[model samples]
Target: MAPTPCITVDHLTVNYRDVQALRNIRLTVQPGKVVGIFGPNGAGKSTLIKAMLGLMPVVTGRVSYGEGTLARQLDRVAYVPQRSQIDWTFPATVWDVVMMGRVKKTGWFNRFSAVSRRLATEALERVGMLEFRDRPIGALSGGQQQRVFLARALAQQAEIFFFDEPFVGVDQKTEAVLFKIFQELAAAGSIVMVVNHDLGESITHFDQLILLNKELIAAGPRDRVLTRDNMTRAYGGHVGFFGHVA
Candidate 1:
């Protein structure tokens, strides 16, 4: 039997008014896999995730989840946007922010019940931010803020997870913690897609790689997809643009 794909994106194209962000992107990811999206700047890495979550306007093609589609199953998906996009100065407690994930399931105008609060606290604990539940979100460091956002996503309890630059400014220890949580999510048969920029670490961390440069460059196991040829192809003569990190 063919493995069930948690996500199937077929010949999808995304446009941002005058700019064509993503072009003819076809991808299928099985459940329980940690897929990494990589390329240099303007590669449409975040655009792809936004398209899948129905946050970006698609000029053409289809994006489906299982046999249905993303639009019909929005509640089953969780999105963690890049930390830089959020307004951290907003008046919100750590617990308040995490509880917001439950808003979709519990509808607006409804207060979070005990069960929702418990789940939110547990997620905070899982990400090592439980101690700061009552603290103001703006008071936390960059890494802590990221973890709070992740805990919020976790509180969503969705089957498919999409994280955009979750490791952007986090420390190695925090990155490891997030990776372990990702592994646990996949182990429980949930798909975890991370939009990442650390090219060197991509080879060692992800189960599968999705290379993009305004088009589908390659999609397969990390070892097969991260070769020098594909690297050069996706990066296009700029493979050595950044110093290699040991």
Candidate 2:
């Protein structure tokens, strides 16, 4: 059977202390596509994902992954917040971090099953961090740290992936690795939505581009969303140069 219900955001609106963060946003995300959320600073790019995930209270609208509400299906969702939002000071090994992904399946008080361990190990290997499995997460470099987290998400095996800012502080190799994994996930029929702050060549990786500026600007292929008018509307400048990523 075809993918049942497409992901839908219906009139999502978010408020921060009476200030409107997002206003009446609506979009649909199909499975097996890597979607990129792009916008200027303070344009609610991050807020849109949080609101859709039910992490933040939405003043209006709802998000549906299929026939059911998305927030209610938390187990099928995997979210990786920005690196800045994490505290690297916390002491935890790379293995420990990857194993955390299985907690939802294993239960808090229960021991991780052999299947969970295998999944974690495979995830580490996929991200090329298996050799550093015993290293403290805090001691690794920024790119290594991001890889470890990516491994954790891979272990989770979620249908819908939400990455707030996966490439905030990483090297070129790390960027390549992330895009590779993201493409792999999409090829396997997963929903990969990334909030990318940078609006450069990296946008090419996304199959769909969602341009935002406190509201919906454009949502479709890069050629449609990357227009000079849309860029000027989002960035508020002449933006004379706007071309399709391809």
Candidate 3:
């Protein structure tokens, strides 16, 4: 079995020019759980992950995975950004996109080995996109495109998975499949973190929640972190709960 990995963010802050995106955020993410990052639009949900991964400039604090800093251990992480961040007209086939996951392992100027090819193939099949392997990415529907990206992340076989708004524009079937895979990854001692804006039934899928409003509002088990007060504070007093708010 693989060793469990954990993420620690200490006094993290992010800024874009003169605007502050995240402020003095702190949290610890344990392994073997599906953690959700939730908040209103522009509440810095995406900014948190990007700052942790060092994709954006940070004004303060640091993110560490296990005993090492995240910047030094990025190869162990797999990140799937929001779908809107991708260019659908990039002129790549579904297979090409998935195989790109292996590029880091395969190295520059090196051809993909048989093992890399097999991993990519298995990832595509797991996401039910093997038949569309040769199809141009632009030809697929929104849900299919999302699945292809999921397959890409799966192919990377990283210990930490960060997904930003994966459920957006996806079909119910795709959503079900994505959550099933996330649960499996967590069960296997991988750290799975998802960024989501919805407060509905889909929120139940997370085992842990990190509620944010440009700062850390609450962080704990789903039920504890989704309290009425935290919801009101994070969503500006407009959140309604039905059936215990999951």
Best by lDDT: 3
- Give TM per candidate: 0.93, 0.94, 0.96
Candidate 3 residue-wise lDDT, 58-168, digit = tens: 889999887789978887888999988889999999999988888865664542788888999999999899999999999999889989998998888888899999999
Per-prediction count of colliding residue pairs?
0, 0, 0
> Which residue window of length 10 is worst by lDDT in model 3?
237-246
Candidates in order have lDDT scores of 0.85, 0.87, 0.89
What candidate 2 gets wrong by more than 4 Å, as runs, is 1-4, 109-111, 240-246
Q: Which stretches of candidate 1 lie over 4 Å from their true place?
A: 1-5, 109-111, 238-246
* Candidate 2, poorest ten consecutive residues by summed lDDT: 237-246
Question: Residues 170-235, candidate 1, lDDT per residue (tens digit)?
Answer: 888888889889889888888899988886543477889899999998998887787777788898
RMSD of each: 2.9, 2.1, 1.6
lDDT of 2 at 31: 82
Sort by TM-score, best first. 3, 2, 1
Badly placed stretches (over 4 Å) of model 3 are: 109-111, 242-246
